[model samples]
Target: MSLPDFSGTTPQERLASLRRSVAGRIVFTTSFGLEDQAITHMIREGGHDIEIVTLDTGRLYSETHAVWAETEQRYGLRIRSFHPDPQALAALLDDWGANGFYHTKDARLACCGVRKVEPLKRALAGAEAWVTGLRADQSQARGDVMAIEFDTGRGLAKAAPLHDWSREDVARFCETNGVPVNALHAQGYPSIGCEPCTRAVKPGEPERAGRWWWEQDDAKECGLHVDADGKFVRAKEAVQ
Candidate 1:
């Protein structure tokens, strides 16, 4: 599926063009963070025909849920929710016990696979394109992200409209547009993921330092962004 060349176009224009170009569905996955809120505002207020979706890990913070609700109300759009497969989740728990992710990197990736990655795969099925709120400054792993690329893992074109935006850029857009954002950002959480695996990063730390802070070397990805090299592959192919 060849995507439209978005060179020299604004993010809004690019998104609109992408929507028009794709014959199949174009989906955007949001975590309800500041960046996602900014993109959500563009999709909603700009009247782009795109499906907004999110993964419910069943372990998200209450504040995240509040922001999700606020976003829906603000934009008057429904953000589709996907969940982990019940049998997969149950089998993971039975094998590793609850909270087994704390023991090893493989265990942690396994938990994230059940909670985030698998759900995202299901959410993106049949979609010609998937949009995300990824920014270059978020982490070294994402530093080289492009505005558009073919996602080999999911066999779809991936777009990151905020690829060149900085944290301040996202915040400013949200502030100026009155976009609903998660309140955790004000309390030092630069990035917000599932409740247990995320924390507040100290000053001077990387934006994603709060996520899986215990893991010193593993990339801070939840399998949603695995590229050709398969940097953070899931632990088990079959859930059970």
Candidate 2:
């Protein structure tokens, strides 16, 4: 399928075309990040019709939840929630203990698969197109992000409307549009995720340096970005 042409068009016009084309099959996954707030604002203000949802990993920051509520109240949009399979999570924890991920890369990834990737897979099932807040400048793995691309790993057509946006651009859009954002961003948590697995970045550290900080060189992402292609190689392999 040919991707929607999101070029040369204003954000409003492109959003309208996306809504008309996908109808009810388009959805946005909001993690309550700054970029998400900007995109949600655009979609809501532009009057584009699409489903908005989030994965309830059951471990997000309270600030994230606060923003989630504020975003809904401020925008008057119903954001659906998807959760992990409780039974599966319980089984995994029973077998590996609550924090076993800290012991090994495999264990950490297994936990992510159980708690995040699986739930997201189910949440996105049957959707024709999924939108994200990923930007090329966010990480080494995301440097090649295209505005519209196929997620071969997820079997979904992914749209990253803000792929080329700088952090300042995202902030400017949010500030100019009155979009609600998570307080954690102002607190140095640029990349928000499950609470226990995330932390605040220190001065002069990379934005993601606080995440999985104990693994030395060989670890970074959990598993969400590694899936089928191994687009991101484990740093351990590079050291070897």
Candidate 3:
């Protein structure tokens, strides 16, 4: 696939350029974080055809839901939500109690897989490109983010337009564009995920220090960005 032009005078221009250049359908998954909110603004203002969706892990914070409602109200755009299959959710609950994930890393990953990864697969179905708000500074596990890459396992092009932008840059963009964002970020939760698996980090902590924080430092990520072949974008050397 030919690489789309990811450069522009502004983030909105870059995203609009992507929409024009990329072939087939494009899906943008937002977690209602600052970075995602910035991208949502670009998509809405530019009136791009990208489908905006989110994975409802069912354990998200109430503030997250509030922001989601606000965004839809502001944009008049219905952000599609992908939920875990009821049967699959039930089976997971039956096997592991609601909070079982806290006890072991395996359990946590299992929960993430059932709640996030599966739903994400459904969300990406029939999509030619998958766009995310991933930034290089979010965490060491994601520190090597690229603007474009071929997700071989999913047979789709993945683009992270804001990969080079810092967290402060995203926040400034949101403020300048009036994009709705989750309120949890102000409470020291720079990287917000499921309520059960997330917390507010202490001073000087990395953005993602709160996500799955109990596990070993290297044991980051919830399998959402992990490929089916056990390879991760951050861990592998850049292909291009």
Candidate 4:
């Protein structure tokens, strides 16, 4: 991959350029979270030709699944669904016995690797660039999320248009545009992920407090975005 000179520009401008370059081959991955919803609206409004996809981690909330159906009907775009390898899942289950994630951090990460990361790797295999709803305000690790990035960590070119958007900005966009959202957000589930691993956050809490609440401070991410050495850096390294 040639590292082209991308003068640091605003997210909107970067998105416009990406659209012009990739045309209809770009893909967006959404989980129907607030940030994801905002991204979907922006790409649509900007008139970018990109396909949207999502991974049904097999343990997602019912509300998330329901919104998927509603979103497709509302947007009139098909969101291709990706699933984990059934044989791989069966093997993991047999070795770890299910619910092993609750036992240790390593165990939990292993489950997430099989359920989310592996499936995502397959989903992005043929794509030139992928868009995500990740926001810089969501976590310190993501504080440097740029509009365009080479995701050497995941072996894909990644673009995060809403990386600089705040939580309030995302909410306003969804409210103003009538974008369908997960019902649990209104119930105080600010950060939504797998059902078992996520819970409703208390009032006046950090947005991501609900995700991996049982783990220590720095162990929030699910290994899907981490480097080979188990470090979570802000920018993606060179994809040799």
Candidate 5:
């Protein structure tokens, strides 16, 4: 499917055009964060036909759940949820304790694979295009992200409506439009993922510093996004 040239259009215009072009083949994944909330508002309030989904890692914060419910109520939309395969999750837990991810990078990635990446693959299976709330300023890994690009990892066209929006811009939009957002964001958690792996960022730290704080490396992504090498690599043996 050929996408319309979104070069000179606003984000809302681009999103509307993408929805019309892709129709039912488009899906949006949200983590209920501030940015995602803004995009959700745009999609829902704009009456776009795009389907919205989320990963339920079972390790999410209560605040995240609260926002999810609130979003549904506010927009009167049902956000589909995807979860890890039970057998795989049980096998992973049996091999490594519940918190095994704290031990090594491989273990952490394995957990992420079962709880996030794998489920995401299923969620995106029939999608021709997927939408994200990613912004270039969020992390070094995403510094080069464009508004629209083909996601080689998922083999689909990925759209980031908020790609150029700033943190302050997102905050102002949410406040001005009354968008539902995670409560954790107010308590210093600029980025919220699974509850155990994420924490609040300290002063002088990057917004994404709160996610996977133990890792000394700067590649803090959970394999949902492409890596610096432009590969969708994840922990070995995660699929089996």
Candidate 6:
């Protein structure tokens, strides 16, 4: 599976090129953050040939849901949503109890594995390209993200159109294009995740300071961005 070296002066143009390059379905997964919203806006407004989808962790903030709905209505597109398996959810609750992720890093990662990463695996099933709204300055783990890379774990090419964009670049695009964004961003939540794990960043904190604030020392990822071999969490089905 060799992918061509795509070229463009802008992210949208590069994305269009990528879309043209792929022969099968190209999926774009959004978390409804500022960066994701920006990418969604570009995908919808440009009318590119790609499928838009999301993972409903079932533990998101109302604000996150609001923005998700708003993006749908604003673009007049129904973004498909994948949710955690009901059986898996019940087993997680029985074993860890609600809010158990707050007690330990392992528990948190397991919760993420069940709630986010597993659903993402389904959402990305059979996709030729997986586009995401990742920026270089987002965090240390993701600082090396290139415009495109092959995800051997998923057996597909992954694209990060906004890889070199700055936070200000995303904000500006969202504002100028009227993209629906999470309301929490205005209240100092530079990074938004599940309501229980995320918080408002303090002054001088990094952009992702709000996510999993209790973990004093860890990368700000939920297993999605990490390499297949270096997954941030262990995704598995619940015991029957």
Candidate lDDT values, in order? 0.83, 0.76, 0.84, 0.78, 0.84, 0.84
Question: Looking at candidate 3, what is the lDDT of residue 224?
Answer: 73
Q: How much does each candidate deviate from the true structure in C-alpha RMSD?
A: 5.3, 5.1, 2.1, 2.9, 5.2, 5.6
Residue by residue across 73-148, what tens digits does model 6's lDDT show?
A: 9989899999999999899999899999999888888899899989999999989889888777888766677787
* Tens-digit per-residue lDDT, 96-196, candidate 4: 87787877888888888888889888888777788788777887776777666787765556777777778998898889999999999999899888998
Better of 3 and 5 by TM-score: 3
How far does residue 109 in candidate 3 sit from its true spot (Å)?
0.9
1-240: candidate 5 lDDT, tens digit per residue: 454344424567778877776745888999999999999998877788888999999999999999999999999988999999999999989988899999998889889989998999999998898889988899887777677777656667788788788999999999999998898988999999999999999999999998889999886788888654635333221100
Please give the distance, in angstroms, between residue 198's alpha carbon in candidate 4 and its true position after superposition. 0.4
Question: For residues 73-173, what per-residue lDDT tens digits would candidate 2 score against the true structure?
Answer: 99987899988899999988898899988898777777888877898888888888887787778876667666666666666667777777888888988
Model 1, span 1-240: residue lDDT tens: 455454535678778877877778999999999988898999987898899999999999999999999988888878899998999999989978888887887888889999998899899999998888888778887777777877767877888888888899889988998888799999999999999899998989999999999888746677778754557322221100
- State, as a TM-score between 0 and 1, how close model 4 is to the true structure: 0.90
**Which stretches in model 3 have alpha-carbon errors above 4 Å?**
5-9, 229-231, 234-240
Off by over 4 Å in 2: 9-13, 217-219, 232-240
Which stretches in model 5 have alpha-carbon errors above 4 Å?
A: 1-4, 227-240
TM-score of each: 0.93, 0.89, 0.93, 0.90, 0.92, 0.93
Q: Where does candidate 2 clash, by residue pair?
A: 218-236
Worst 10 residues of 3 by lDDT: 231-240
lDDT (Cα, 0-100) at 168 in candidate 6 = 94
Give one clash count per candidate, in the order shown.
0, 1, 0, 0, 0, 0
Q: What TM-score does prediction 1 earn?
A: 0.93
Model 6, position 5, has a per-residue lDDT of 51
